[model samples]
Target: MSWRFVSLPPQDGYHMVTSFVSVADYVSRGGRNTLLVFSVKEPFVNVGVHQEVWLEVDLDYTSKAGIPVVRRDLGGGTVVITRGEHDYFVVVNQDEAPSDPKALYAKYLSPVVEVLRDYGLNAQLKDQDIVVNGKKISGNGAMTHGKAVVLAGNILMKLDVDLMSKCIRVPTEKFRDKMAKDMSEWLTSLERELGYVPPREELDKKLKASFERNLGIKFEDSSLTSEEIEEWERLAREKMEEEWIYYKDRRHPELRTERCVKISSSVAICHVDYKARKLLRITAKFLGGKLAEVSISGDFFVMSPKGFIELLEERLTNLSPEDIPKEIDRVFEEKKPTIFGFTADDLKKAFLEIVNKPEVREVI
Candidate 1:
């Protein structure tokens, strides 16, 4: 079988390329060996197939900044990508690939490592990540579609590290200034590692050579067939839809939130510890909601759970008399939870009724 190399121009093109490659590989009976590599414009938060977007992201921040949130069909931790990141996707027949996942990475990413080495950077595969000097520069994930396995990853040519940190919601107190400094020191970009910005075409050529040498296959430059192009457009449109990006699972409610106040979702009941400023303990009673349970144990810290309750009280004081469902829908839209079978508005109304009065303010 001959290998086909298709270079997709950088755009909202990653999803399209993957879909087309999967279709071609399946329809052609593994006869079409293809490499689909593309880049995307604007930063997007791509989550795993099973991840909850709200739990994985700070939606308030992402929405205000105009960043798009995408739930990919693959499984992995959430990844932030921008125009600078170089993305690679490979579609191979499972029959041709070794059964072990590590072997798959070795087969595809070994070429990437070779290309980085050619550029004077010591790049090696560590598990599934491509690391340069022990800091991860690339992360890879894969999923099976029909008879094909699609492996995709991005090379950190240049990353906006600060924006990436902000885009993904990590408990801020966990990383002190000194710890943050130490963490930043570990990350290395291609420009930083190579001492200069390499031309895009040059980088692509290096990758092409690496694959050819490592895989013992020749790559012929090819364009998408008419059927493939049509498929790509259809997939792209589907990806761009809000419903697909936001709520593919029917079990996920429209919105949910975690505050200092005592709030119960259909799945879990949360009680925050005021002194700890984090979740004291969460009891998950149902499985339909995305989050099972969360423990604020160990060294994790946040605004006192009591403080969060006070904030909720203040925010909901004027709405105590409002209709329940209307309030729930409004709050759900505002907070946008991935758990809590009910909406944010519903939680607010329920909490107010449970307390029987607004919470008193206490100075922290």
Candidate 2:
């Protein structure tokens, strides 16, 4: 199907996020047209839908700097965006895209990978992000809102590591310093990697061409429909309210404490204490590239047969780290179990934290 490419003028934080929801709404109601929106917005910080605003952002600094802090309806951590950064939103019917989270990310981001490769970067989709030389160049996520499937993220042109670190409220100055240093080493931008950043118009042309080639679909330039504009305005107003910006879902800290240690090349152990609706603590040992054992303990309420957590833990054993998310999905689907305050994604995220332990890669 042909897609509509909408290049919106630079907007505020509220409009930038609301546009995606509005487009999703438009597509959900028999609108055959898919959409690709490029959001050029002012500097601001946007937290994940599930994250705590107080824990992630410095409200005083943002308020003083006139930088808005908004929450997006997506999972992941906070991100800072500004004029030089390029944020793209791909809106299509859920059926039009792959259903698997990993597959869906690759399907939408393959074109982006191609674009980066053309610029002489050895870019690949690692986990959920596009990375070059083991450093992230693009970050993306996918979500299903009703019938519309949205994959959105930013292509880094340049990043202010110091500013980003300053805006976040970490537990200590030492931790904040470490975070800033890590970000400088772990994040890459077009200008930093290539020594020059292409103009927005040039990047747009290359991106459009890549999408057309990779997806085998053509796009026509278009403006927002009356319906879409109405929806955008309504969503903007609603999302801009203080209630939504300061929203909190977890009854406790999302990730309270996490630690991982490597014993040998083929053996490692990890412990993660996290909270969603309640609280969960995971202790896992990995051996020979598989989960040798796992334990789940917390204050979470599970409405299932006794020992359901044991069943879940047993199922997780002997599985490859990369396959945990799929296994969790299967267990939930087949068991039809109800885990209060936490969804399958939350479980998957917590489990991946163990898989992504630093020691897991040091051996390789």
Give the top-scoring candidate (TM-score): 2
Please, what is the TM-score per model? 0.68, 0.72
> Model 1 off-target regions past 4 Å?
13-31, 172-183, 248-250, 254-283, 286-364
Local accuracy of candidate 1 as per-residue lDDT tens digits, 1-364: 4677878777753463346444544445744677777778678887655455656676778889988787666656666777777877777776787655667778889999888888878888987789998988888776556676677787888867666776776557455344446547876678778767677777778888888888888899987777777766667777777776665233335224444332333233333322221112221111232223232211111111222322333344333233433544554466543221222443544433323322211100
- Candidate 2 TM-score over all chains jointly: 0.72
lDDT of 2 by residue, 255-295 (tens): 22346778898877777767765456677777888888776
lDDT of each: 0.59, 0.77
Tell me the deviation in Å of residue 286 in model 2: 30
Q: Against the true structure, candidate 2 has what lDDT?
A: 0.77
Off by over 4 Å in 2: 249-331, 334-364
Backbone clashes in model 2, listed as residue pairs: none
Residue 289 accuracy (lDDT) in model 2: 83
